[model samples]
Target: MAGRGGTQGKSGDEVVERGGERDAGGGGMEGWKRKGKRSPDSSLRHVFPTPSAFPLFLHMAGSEYGRTARDVLVACLALWSVTSLVVIAVWRTSPGVRSMERCKAELHRARGRLEEARAEWGRRREELQDLLRKSAQNQTHLRRQADQLTQSLRNSDASVSRCLQGRLTYSISRYLVF
Candidate 1:
């Protein structure tokens, strides 16, 4: 039974492999045949087309008929002058230019204010740190004073107990004698 199953699997794989190969070859060859039939004529027609009127006009304009180099320089200078005048006019009349100037002024003021604020904050922070250090020193000093007071109170309590015990012993001796 195992041998029969192996043979069936091999036959199924062969059939699928053959079908895939046929499909791939048919698609590739059909595209190639269609492109090969149209490419040569189309490429030749586009590459060798006759010149039109617009191209002729462009050629005439680019050619120097009788104009001197000085004339060309003068023409270029005039064009540049006109272009600069137009640009200056636009800049002076445009609202965006004025808005940009206002924004720059406002930005400068904001930067000045920010610097002032940062300086003030630094000063305040230093003051706070100094106060904190002083507070810590005061706390330490108070703690030391409290410890000294506690020690003195303990010594005084010990002395008072000794005096009381001595008085009690003296009284008991006198009574026993009587």
Candidate 2:
């Protein structure tokens, strides 16, 4: 008879022995076999003491509790996934999130405006420098023209004075000769 701690060794209808016990004949393989057959009640009595202990056995054989545990695990995982998704959605629609997005957009616009202003300043500076250069060239040209005009006026005045004096001297000589 197999106890609760030992395995039954043989197929049906052949007498199964417990823990490979030897028969009285002491034959090697033949003694191991040919043990008297036992009833099903006697075999199961050593495994389970009461009828309620059957379901309390190991759950590794695809029992009811095994399926229930798997279902519970899946449900918990699904609940966690839904909770995380809700949190993310709520955060995205929050006031702080919207404010942050607005600030980012404003910063980008400000940067673009600053760049445009810098470029305009560069162009205006170049135009001012060109105007200043042209103004200096014009002043130099006008000074040269004014100096030439003054020299011409002085030469004309000297020639006119000398001609008038010579005419006056000739008239006086004519008068004395007459």
**Residue 96 C-alpha lDDT in model 1:** 97
Model 1 segments beyond 4 Å from truth? 1-89, 170-178
- What is the Å distance of residue 81 in model 2 from its true position? 2.9
Candidate 2, residues 97-161: lDDT per residue as tens digits?
99999999999999999999999999999999999999999999999999998898888878887
- The model with the greatest lDDT is 2
Off by over 4 Å in 2: 1-79, 163-178
The number of the candidate with the highest TM-score is: 2
Model 1, residue 124: C-alpha shift (Å): 1.3
Candidate 1 local Cα displacement, residue 25, angstroms: 92
- Using alpha carbons, what is the TM-score of model 2? 0.50
